[model samples]
Target: MKRLTITTLLAVAILSGCSSTEEVVPDVPPAELYVTAQQALQSGSWTTAIERLETLDSRYPFGAYSEQVQLDLIYAYYKNDDLALGEATIARFNRLNPAHEKSDWVLYMRGLTQMAQDRSFMHDIFSIDRHDRDPEPARKAFRDFKRLLDRYPNSQYAADAKARMIFIKNRLADYDLATVDFYIRREAWIAAINRSQQIQKLYPDTQAARKSLPLMLTAYEKLGLQEPIENTKKLIALNPVN
Candidate 1:
């Protein structure tokens, strides 16, 4: 009798625990979830906001706040430093709402997500042309920002986008100059000259292009190429350092 009574109590306690666990996230109304997410966001609880917004987004795809929930989720992902997820959410938002009035904001966020990628120096030196190299996130950010400006010239985001595009352009020229430096280190004068010339051709306005001219002159002198040396000198004279 005593054993059977103890077994029954244990079973009841287990069932009660399971019930409490199951009810932790009961099917709440969409408004309730949205409010919870909004509170979380207001409190700067990014993780909680993400959880609630994700749940809200899933449970109420066509609900009144569906679009807002998606936007919130994208922002939460960004705040959480989960850039890959933020990028995925941005793509989904764009796909589902091609004509959204806030499309420019989405483009802005997408550019930020791309620009936030790793920019550390690589273990392997880059020797290839800028176009031939792995498509850097900086380049993608530049393209996305360009699209934002082109599609919505008067967008509030256009000024910032143009600024970032300039930064990216300079960054790209700097990377190309790194290749030029690597070629110089290897005593590959012709390769260095080619990269430097390409930098000037592709990035005429960049400081790196101006910096490359002297390096190109060095290569020409090393190769005993008199005419090219004089031409490079003339070019350098035209663009003296400020």
Candidate 2:
């Protein structure tokens, strides 16, 4: 009897422990979830906001806040440093709402996202030179911002978009200059001259154009290309030296 009684107690304890160990998920309603997410965002609790927003999206795909939640999710993703996810979310939004009246806002945000990514943490924080780094993100951001400007010239976001576009363009010019430098270093004078000329043509008003003239002159002189050397000198004369 004693052994049987002890066995029963053990079984009861095991059952009690199992119950205590079970996970309890909150059964928040979609509307309440969205409210919670908004609260989390206001509090700067990005992780909590992401969780609530994602839960709301999953639980109520067609809820009243569906579109708004998706939009907010992009900002949350960006804030959380999940750039890839943010971009993917933007793509989904664009695909779903191609004619959205607020598409300029989306384009602005997309441009900002790409601009943020183009910024290199290593270069920014560590003081490393990113002139030779990949310029694709900057290029993409420039295009997005340009599109926003073309589509909505008076948009409230246009000023900021234009500012970012300028920065990206300069960075792109620097990237071209970096490539020209690389060719110059390799003693590939003809390649350097050709690339420098292209930079001058493609980025006429850029600092790259200013720098490319000197580079082209050097490359032409190196190769005894007198005609091109004289032409490069004339181009350099167009920019008055400070």
Candidate 3:
């Protein structure tokens, strides 16, 4: 939903015409295409890998390397920043091979793809405050990684998934903190206090919670609530961010 329409049609487009300029001929044998795709992947040429893999997929549906081709194509899409195609291709792979042994890897890639979505090169170069950005991609990535762990606890990607989940949690906490800051800047004391209290309750262990303690105290002081201000000060004292 974030990128392109997540539908079977998108999957078809991923197979048929992923690259507008590079046309892949269907006459090539699947093995040759697989070899070429592998070379492209090894050389870190994502566009070339995607072209060869898509050709193999469309031309030889049940070919010997179909499963691997789909997986490789998904990886290529991610490397090329073609997140929507990667997502759609992942969905297609799960639909076709429900119980495939590599499904755990696919799940990890799905999370990785969503995690890498909506990122901007300018944002990376600039010291941008991105807590204001949409948190849906982080949420989706969290969900994907959670599902991966739920289904396959022993997966090779489990450790990295757990690490990503931690970052996702911090991202959500930061988003909530950003909203609290918005209310604070607007002089909406009650709204800010409410949201800051929510942050303290929901993410008490997070760095946002540590930041929120002061914000909540500020909100309380602004509202002339001495008791709340004192309580928030105590929270800040008790929870020192290290």
lDDT of 2 by residue, 1-242 (tens): 98798678768867875774423327977777788899989998877888888787788888899899999899898887778989999999999989888889889988889987886644664477677789888888999999999999999999999888777877888898899999999989988888887887778778887988888888889999789888878988986434
Task: Name the candidate, 1 or 3, with the larger lDDT value.
Answer: 3
lDDT for each residue of candidate 1 in 139-169, tens digit (9 for 90 to 100): 8999999999999999999999999999888
**What is the overall TM-score of model 3 with all chains considered together?**
0.86
Supply the TM-score for candidate 1.
0.80
- Model 3: weakest 10-residue lDDT segment is 1-10
Global lDDT of model 1: 0.84
Clashing residue pairs, backbone N/CA/C < 3 A, model 1 = none
Question: On a 0 to 100 scale, what is the lDDT of residue 14 in model 1?
Answer: 71
Segments of candidate 2 deviating more than 4 angstroms:
1-25, 240-242
lDDT per residue as tens, model 3, 29-58: 677778888999999988888888888888
Q: Which rank order by lDDT, best down to worst?
A: 3, 1, 2
Winning candidate number (lDDT): 3
Best by TM-score: 3
Model 2, total clashes = 0
All candidates' TM-scores?
0.80, 0.84, 0.86
Runs in model 1 lying further than 4 Å from the true structure: 1-27, 120-135
Please say which candidate is ahead in TM-score: 1 or 3: 3
